[model samples]
Target chain A: MEKIPSSEITPESVYLSRRRFVGSLGALAASALLPSGLRAADRFEELRKELTPLKSITSYNNFYEFSTQKEAVAGLSQGFRTSPWTVKVSGHVRNPATLDIDDLRKKFPQEERIYRLRCVEGWSMVIPWMGFPLASLLKIVEPTEKAKFVRFETLLDTKQMPGQGASWYSWPYVEGLRLDEAMNDLAILATGLYGNPLPPQNGAPIRLVVPWKYGFKSIKSIVKIELVGSMPISLWMRAAPNEYGFYANVNPAVDHPRWSQSSERRIGEFFRRKTLPFNGYSEQVAHLYAGMDLRRNY
Target chain B: MVWLKRAGLPILAHAGALTPLALLIWNFFHDQLTANPIQYITFRTGKTALVLLVLALACTPLNVLFGLKQAVALRKPFGLYAFLYAALHFVTFVGLDYQFDPELLKEAIFKKRYALVGFAAFLALLPLAVTSTRGWMRRLGKNWKRLHRLVYLAALLAVVHFVWLVKSDVREPLAYGAGVIVLLALRLKSVRRASAKLREKLVGKQGECRQVAVHEDLR
Candidate 1:
């Protein structure tokens, strides 16, 4: 049970508040002034007193488009081109225009939201993501009456991302959210993390951040947003339909074949913590599935 | 050359098996084990155990298919190394990862099918590991060979455990499964006889090896 030093524990918030809190206060003063993120209702305050280091958050990743190996992703995705990127908002939308990455940033105000990302592989991380709500972005591109689902596609450059063309999964990784789920406040299109514009590994320019679902639903380096009439099958669903479903919402009771969702190992924590339903965002997002059966959905 | 075959080969085998473990320890001390160190260690050890198990299983097949008698000499050491790593894998799971929590351990063993099969594989290997010594081999006599047949079941279970573990992309595990299958297939009496006959008809026909490798009595 080796402990990370207390000094390194509260290191990210100051350096992370890059754009908004620029030169406002000293690092020490800012840490004191800054609100310790959404841990008020968190019962394990004593257990997880500090945030996961920005180094760990950046280094340990599940960017399969870069590599299957988690640690190798950061290094492999080094040369991935992000700038001059255009995210095409197409499919069943009123204003189906391909917006430039920079102009899109200007259009939407980015705010930092610290969310606990529970991976389907039983590992979890608390990431301070800088982005605007997906609802905000969705409002700009008004969905037509036929738009029942929102499908996202990651960048498909095999040249930039070495693992893109891998046969293990279909190319240009696709994830879908119901129209209501897409409009959820908790769901955001993340552009940056740890007070910095995303490095190539962490989805670079823009990626989805659906906090309540398994991390895979948060597709990275999104190149296309298709508002579809039918429920779009995600890449995981195509790969293993039985194991991975369309709605990959984090549920403790739903026991996966490989790893149990009942408990998860928070990256920094040594002991396994009991996983929460909807990843503890039940109050925020649970009402979306009021009458539906979660087990079948899972 | 005989001395090299007798001593040097065993030493090389021992070194080859132990080096990854040494490197893992070195990485742990150097802070190079990435973010989730426990997971890194678990993956490394489990992979090593699987590889060593595959290598151990391949030894007899190598002898049967090609009459490489020296492969037999390496089997016990490789099997023992695989057992050591399997034990370490379990210890890491129960102790470091789960923190010896009884409830968590029970749930992991019972609820997770992969864990159950992997644990069963470990249990199968335990008796073989305990009776691996010459004294125990002498005491067990003919039953030693019969008891050690559990290695095949252990290997199969390990493959099943691996196959079930992945969410998608059965490619990597399937590659390992193919390797295990080939090695296991080579062990079959009919497959061995056919392969030996094929080799004899090709290259071994001209040589002094007319007796088509009935060498591995365990086969």
Candidate 2:
């Protein structure tokens, strides 16, 4: 693995030379470079402006599998076992295999991706995630032409996750993305954050990070990844179809029936800032829904 | 002892009602209000307001059912506390969250259904809070009861506001809805009549006990 000085990296340079950076740095240095206190955005100028504190990113979360209260999730999720895990990749893929978590780490080299996570509840956070691109994983699985959507599922154990016992939502939380969206470079299968293993409350072992959509769309603690011909029903969408749509892309123009999506309070800020279209990734993901009506879909 | 019972209990209730606010202040000063303090404060105050509103609504029913005269004395203080929290909740949204941006605040109230419902709930409680004093109560006379009845509507609107505000999970709001429904059901004419009958039976027993005590004292 090549060692590039952190001072040399800028947001523009990082974005322009992502593949080169990922290829050179490889697996060895990704974890070594990310000290817990170091802001992932410190080396990148654009991201530095809004990066949320590591404490907030780990502590303030909406992993309903633990609890609803943001502060309570950390303590409640302490019992979760993340190691000795395996993720099954099957369904409409040409290669169907259950790969151990350790094998996955060695298979794909880690890349550092800084992303803004916007919650549907009107708060946002900027996090530095360490992971490999979803496209890389999909390529390994060799998704067949019949696969229209990529479905993801979180582990379901009432003993491990106490919230699973509640009938408020269907257990074994699931999420999905269109095959095109899944193959997008922006979508990542993250393993760690702030240079360390994922804290249990923030989804441990492995998770998906879709930057352009609401935070809930980035399902956590993924146990299964299935390529399906039909669109998979997501946990939130199934529970409240009206509130949580399948393509929960962050669009300020498309207000939720109950609340305004026009602005969001940045986790550390006092006042709300105007929300951007596609969470400021409009140039990349907006074309995905070109002719489709966002308001109707939302 | 009589003075303490009459005055001290209400004072204690007032302190109890302010505990949420006190905790919020302490948390704010200690930097423990979490990352999104504005959102935290907004939710905290809104929840406290709703809880106090429900507690205030329960007071009249308690008086009607078991004839707890002390519960009647608590109604004004609880309602006022609810109003105080509701006002704080609104102020947090307008002053802190919106930073007093008129355009944003207008859009929130006019365009957002949850904010509109929340604003309406607060407005409904405003007149009731203002008329809580003995002077206004006497001046309004018969109209005061009719006006104060708006609390039920306010409570319903507040619950709706909460239910709509949540992105997906409705369990918390639904629980509040059930509580409000049960409280509202107790106010029905038939339920009131049944409660009156039960109240008479209990009051009759109390009267018999008082009479026996008087006879023993005379002997």
Candidate 3:
């Protein structure tokens, strides 16, 4: 496993203290100190992208579990319960167990990773996600050699997620990645955002964050993680096979049948910027698809 | 009641037609249009175009099925409104969204299938809009009706463009598709003939009234 740089890891106490200091400064003073566009954390300066405002990140989302309308999801997700959540890790594993959210948090040390989220819908956002690498959790479960793919499932409570009642998509949205991709150092099971618990609309409790793939592959509000021999079918692929494929890597060369993928609009910006292949994580993730044709897979 | 029918109804229709654009402008000023204001504006304008197009198509059928002669007068205004919204939708995409980048716009029109369909629909509406005036109607004479029939094709293409553009949850587009189909079905020759026959049977000796109604509407 690749080691995270010690300089990048801010102690939890320091993080809390900084938040208090920033909050005490209030909105007007903070705006005076930092320019509007330079809102991202100092640690993420290496990425050269601004963090999408927390308002935009929480408000404008594609969690179809709440509603198809991007603006409606945040409001509709207000009733959802994240605490007392338990995640079931099973299938093709030596030690399959149902772990409580608290247990999962205590067992692994969390790290804040700033990653660019490129949506399949031609929009992008940089998010400061706080979570541990998914590999640590998979190690605890002890996946057997037969585990070729890792499948994820979201919560299915229709009362909480009203869009599940509609036939737009099948219930309990499912997503999957190859076992190797799941085990990658960049892959994270995010628990929080902006140093706070994950917002309900942004997939509260826990969510997957595979930065290289389009945002949908990072399925939200996860309840199940399973390892299987054969490739697992995902919801988007089942809904529209031609438009959304299994790999769903952010590729500028390959366009979605309906829209262009060559460029994407950053959330707060008026103009679009050229999209990056594998969402600019090409060095880390491009090797995974070597020898295979991405266009065919897409 | 007579004044209301003669003048008030058309005024109401015009106001109704402009409400979406007005509401969008209001939302823009208030900062209530969501995170991506451009997307909100584009979608609202596109939806307004489709809705007005459907309403314009419905005008002829309103007179055919019912004896609403005043509804035929609404066709021109609604058709023009539809064209205005479609033009706005196109301008927003090419100007605001693409920022007049010819290469990007060209790629969108040529390479993207949905864009091609949507642009085709807009192009089909253009000439009809230009010739909508009374002078052009008089100059074209018999050819005017033939030219106006192109609205049906434009409506079909517009609905298909919407259906193709959506990622999933196509219920909204499907409903619009159903509306277009229903309007087209109502205008079919066989359906018109059956309706005429039914009108003739109902009015027996006063059948000239039905012919006059058909001439004014089906034209």
Candidate 4:
């Protein structure tokens, strides 16, 4: 599944290219990451070695109703809408694209990368997400200088999503990141998890996965990608400004007004443990915020 | 000592019976329970409170139906349990759910209908608890009986609160509501019967006095 990289690729072709790239690179990365002793698809098992535990299970949720508990998302999201899905890439892009789900899957070469997911509520989860770097997808969109940030929009219909109908939370979630953050190598366009297609609750079809930021920053069930010169509005931050901030980085020192961010409860941890800063990935992302005060930013 | 035998031991026993509750709390703090333990804690406390409340209400019937002289002992403990769980329920909703934001609390009460009913129910429970102590009961005397009557009101409000708190698929709340209605109806019927008998005695005494006065004037 060799993807022909081109400058003027059609949205349809770009979509197809992404899926091919994902499937191929995923295999390639597996072989690269694993020792030769392991066989084909055997690398997923090695990748599973890095299939780490979350810093906190409570925060690692998609808010899907199937499971009343946090760990229930895996079981509940099995029925997530995957096929016939489409992501419309519009607003400030050089070329407006309406990419079909099948084509997008074929276009991207998947790679399994382990990352930590820190929630705004002082909890964290670590997962081995399967997809290519978001940089690859952004490369196809080719944002102009005016594209200061990338905004993501989730599907909002309450008829399909019962959570939206209830007062549990607001629906049609929106999340965004600065252009630089969106293009970071850590940023991922996830299509699958734990060596399978993405669960419906985990932003099935295609979703942005920003590891360095809070879990909400990685929106699920994306239907629109907007590149804007202006700072795009974020839903959670707007909902409660003091509790939620625009830059939801994982910093143990900066406590939320309600709870201490210094510690978290891992899902299977017999004892709740003190939280690690940057969810134990400080080596990767601490440099990005080296000079800035996370407390103020938080 | 006599009062202790009558009232204080039951209260002490009720308070001591919180051992399981203490264990649950210990389980949560020690991390023996699941993460996001607040939801579990909240639900467990609520269910326990509900059961105790039903038991508290049933004490009167037990005194009448089964002739259990010690049924009064259950009232204080069960009432206190209901109060404890109600407090926990509110704490979970405010602490875990809203993160102690007064603004969010205000918004929920103002914008959300369920929140409004829930808040009202919480307020109703406050007076009933404050008037629960024997000291307060003694201090108020007759006023105490009038104030403690708030329990019935509080019970009605709680049922309403639960019923409205559920948006749809309300079979559970409806059952609770029906139970509350029947219990309250029994009390209402008994009160009406007593008042009717008292009115008849007063009227008959007045009629005899009038007849005697006429007989004296004719003689």
Backbone clashes under 3 angstroms, per model? 1, 0, 0, 21
Per-residue alpha-carbon lDDT of model 3 for B168-209, expressed as tens digits? 878889999999999999888888778777878887656657
In model 2, how well does chain A match by TM-score? 0.85
Give the runs in model 2 whose Cα sits over 4 Å from its true position: A1-45, B167-169, B201-219
The DockQ value obtained for model 2 is 0.54
Model 2, B83-184: lDDT tens digits are 999999999988988888787777787778888999999999999999999999899978888898899999999999999887557888989999999999
lDDT of 3 at B141: 93
Q: Give the number of the best model, judged by lDDT.
A: 3
lDDT of 1 by residue, A76-113 (tens): 98877888899999999998989899988899988777
For candidate 3, write residues A120-216 as lDDT tens digits. 8888999989998899999999999999999999999988888899785777899999999998878999999999989999999999999889999
Interface RMSD of 2: 2.0
Lowest summed lDDT window (length 10), candidate 2 chain A = A36-45
True-vs-predicted CA distance for residue B98, candidate 3, Å:
1.6
Worst 10 residues of 4 chain B by lDDT: B210-219
Candidate 4 Cα errors over 4 Å, as ranges: A1-60, A64-78, A166-170, B1-39, B46-74, B83-219
Interface RMSD of each: 1.6, 2.0, 1.4, 9.8
**Candidates 1 and 2 compared by TM-score, better number:** 1
Model 3's TM-score against the true structure: 0.89
Could you list the chain B TM-scores for each candidate?
A: 0.91, 0.88, 0.94, 0.70
TM-score versus the correct structure, for each prediction = 0.87, 0.86, 0.89, 0.57
Q: Every model's DockQ, to 2 decimals?
A: 0.60, 0.54, 0.70, 0.07
